[model samples]
Target chain A: MSSAALVELRDVVVGYGELPILTGVDLRIDTGEIVSVIGGSGSGKSTLLRAMVGLLEPAAGAVCLFGQDLYATRPRSRGRLLSRVGVLFQSDALFSSMSVLDNVMFPGRKLTDLPDAVIQELALIELARLGVADLAERMPQEISGGQAKRVALARANVLAPELVFCDEPTSSLDPINAAVLGREFTRLRDDQGSTVILVTHDMEMVRTLSDRTVVLAAGGICAVGTPATLERSEDLDVQALFHGEPTRESQESKRA
Target chain B: MDVRLDAIRPRSLLHELEIHARTRPAVLRLDLSALRQIDSTGVATLRAVTRRLRRSGVAVELHGATPEVMRVLAETPEPDPPKHPPEPGVLESLGRSCFAWWSGLLTLADMVIEAMQGAAGAVVGRRTFAWRDVVEQLELMGADALPIAATMSFLLGLVLDFQTWVQMHYYGTESVVLEFVGIGMARGFAPFIVAILLASRTAPAIAAQLSTMEMRQENDVLRVMGISPVRHLVVPRLFAITLVTPALSLIATASGILGGLLVTVWLDPHWMAAFETMLREMTLGDLWLGTVKSVLFGWVIGLASAFTGLHSGYGALSIGIAATRAAVASILFVMIVDSIVTTLWTMAQ
Candidate 1:
């Protein structure tokens, strides 16, 4: 265990109401690492991401960010810690009323001292990088799912924040665009030295790009290794999941 | 391009910085000796401007600052706006405004046409009408709202009767209060009460439901299934409100008149005389006119809220915002339509 973990969740128990989803979940994500969390459908992957990001509180144990207990700290301190992080939700949760330009420019406006001109320039550059600059004036509802995802990415990265959590960032994008986004995430880690956490089942992304791959099953992390190591594991469940082979969960879901 | 002879100590430094950017100054130096007082905002703005200039391929150096100013400058950077957001060009802004207005008008027009068609189809027994949903909405918005409407109208009648009786008492002609309350209740008060109450309550309910559905993409799912949301979802609410508003108005009139009667009998032993006077003056025409106005009010509220919900942006916050807009727009339009209808009917009468 490195003493310099950016985010560490120890024996975390998380759930919705009474239905426990992820129990005793322990994980450590280090600085400047692009860590991908992979799971079967309904394996509490998003819940883990949500808990780690402080959007959902753990039912038990400690979740720390940047060495401070995120939920236990005073609100001001928590906010100060959170301001360094960016998130791209699975829903592409853009403000519906704002134009794409304003949506992308929002974080810089709210979180930084950068002048409007500078922020706009940054936001435009980000949008152009993601190939959504032409859609800047359109509302979120007017854009396609893939375009919205790109716009969300631009918004998330506009400030070049120190930490980022992306949920299904390229699910809707085509192969080329997903590849572009994968490279962008790499640049985020390499250029800005930002920690990138991706909650995805995009195997190509996991295999080719991520520094580490964490597989979630039952209620907690089942395996944590390099993608290749996980793929070659003796664990039958890991192999079944990697090859999309039917397991008990899949069989149950099919019946359901 | 090494333009480094700047000793400007002017307060309007940002303007000077922008001017320097255009000239492509390689190095810029600021003499801050005249800067006596500097707040955190000023410090952040200075940094932001310098950072911007540096990003644009310029080097900015600050010199001649007192320790106090230097302390402020070294403080942690916070958010501060040095300039308003760059505006869209005039033509682009104008184009957006025009398009927005046109879209709003189009949404309203779309709602009105669909509402009318739904109502007509339901009346004509067309299979396209969502009669089942209409019944459910009526139960939800109409029956559930009866007690509040009736109680509110009862209070209005009590207040009106008491105030009028006090004023009329001075002239020894307080009996006119009975007839006045009766005519007022039948002609305007009941309809106004029912319409306003529903506008405040049911309009927002409709807006929230529809907006949430839209946000969750449930409306889109309906569209994908080859069902029009307007026909299947909105028409039911429209029919229910249109019918329910008039019925509630009529019920409210009775409740109000009953309240006035209670006040009349309490104040005077010859309550029969007052009751007869009220009955004589309460014409059916006044009742019908009030009901007609209520129908229109129902349409205004239903359509405004429906239009707002359909056009609402995605997300829970936008759903809440849409509901608020629905409540305000429905109430405002209801009042405006009330005044116009009242004036036109008075002229005809």
Candidate 2:
């Protein structure tokens, strides 16, 4: 209910075609907060992030960004709205045809009217921040999956967006790369005061990086608490999910 | 239905417009049967200048809101809207398909037009063309094909002559062997037969190569690297076939005539006299026509085969299908094009 809420989704319902996926979801993200949404596949974590970014229209409810309704605006104005919210796709989605530097420059090229030299400089700075500046001129195909992920992150953050959405950013990366990206996400939120909404099921990431956590189950918010509190939830479903425990009836049946 | 009004820009008009717009939008409509007389100014303002509006907050249906509104909205030209096309119907769905049965038939007709244009382009592009691929294609398609062409031409001539001589010896017309072979090789037979062989053999081979490269995304890679696949791949084969086909035809002709000469020498006592007499009767125009046909056939086969390969889809099955179709279509097109050119040339004469 705070007026300072950077993004607020009120009773949102999202779906593809006629198949209802996420139903009546409500969430709020404030500036400089790193919020992680954790769930297994088919839980609609990614869909919620896309809906927040104005990429998908909610079937119901309002997606408000600083009190402005995102989907209600025209596409050009919506794109201008998107300039304030950077999104890293699950697949990285870097233009495989372009070099790493050019990939990093993509958002800036789309969002800003900066000159060529400034764009190049910003691209280099972003790549350097992500510690992959040396691979600037190499095509996406030439890089490892982890490097590609970081390059995508670098691209996402280059516009200095007020909010960043990362969907399964570390799914393909190694532990080392995941840890590096985790640090980068923290720095983005703490140092730069950019709100970060990471959509991932990586528990280690949720525990280590997230300032707050939202747990989705069957397309709805199952739990919203500090990661520790969610981890310690005494509710049967929460306890079973967190501990990977079988239900009592299933256990009894197996024993029989 | 209970509705909420957040805030209106002009508060004075709110009281009047609220009953009409509250349930829907700032720009709205109501069934006039449910209401008495309405204010025309309110209708005009709603129709004229509202930038944001929604009906029922669920869907965008401003179609029948107001005739004046619809007119004004129509006046607000949208060159390109965010188009989310509805799912297609049966015929529409098939029409959307690129490689459908009917589409394939259309593509066949299209290929003929493309082949003609391609042949013209190939001829023009051939002038300044320099590439290593031409030499490579020549080695693979032409030089390697020589032994087969030569062998077939020799055996065909030798068999025909031997058969004719046995029959002609009874009539003492065996001296005409020179005339028969000379006219056959020079006029049309040798070049036509050689071109068919090459079309069946080399055209498919070129198409298969280009198709594999296409399926593997190699052609796209080259394009992304600022290389024109047409220039890099097609033009080279164009030059190669143009040079090689004519040479192979000439070789086949010489080898065939030599085989005929050997038969004449073996059967007739005055073999030299027979040949010299035939030579005197034959003109260079006969040779020129055959050579021209070979060259044209070469260009056609090269271009058509390359076109098939380049246009192939991105699948393993598609590559094989494209290669096979290219071979068959190239031969068919070559024959058709040659027939048309020959008919036209004959008509002009």
As a whole number from 0 to 100, the lDDT of residue A120 in candidate 1 is 94
Q: Kindly report the root-mean-square deviation of model 1 from the true structure over all alpha carbons.
A: 22.4
lDDT of candidate 1 over B1-349, digit per residue (tens): 3333233333566776788788887788877777777876676667778889988998888878889988877776665556886889999999989998998898788768866776677788865454767889999889999999999999899889888998888998888788898889888899999998998899999998889878865454233222456876788898899899999999999899888888888897787988898888878999998899999999899988898898898865988898899999998998899899889999998
* Model 2 score (lDDT): 0.73
lDDT of 1 at A64: 90
lDDT agreement with native, every candidate: 0.83, 0.73
lDDT of 2 by residue, B122-143 (tens): 5575432345556788898788
For model 2, residues A1-256, the per-residue Cα lDDT tens digits are: 5475788889999988677688878888888988998776788887787678765688889998866788887644665566677777777767664699987876666456788689999999989988899999999889998998899889888878888888887897899998889989988998889999889878778888888888888778878888888876755555555666647876565457
TM per candidate: 0.49, 0.45
**Each predicted complex: what DockQ?**
0.02, 0.02
Off by over 4 Å in 2: A1-256, B1-130, B341-349
Worst 10 residues of 2 chain A by lDDT: A234-243
Among these predicted structures, which one has the highest TM-score?
Answer: 1
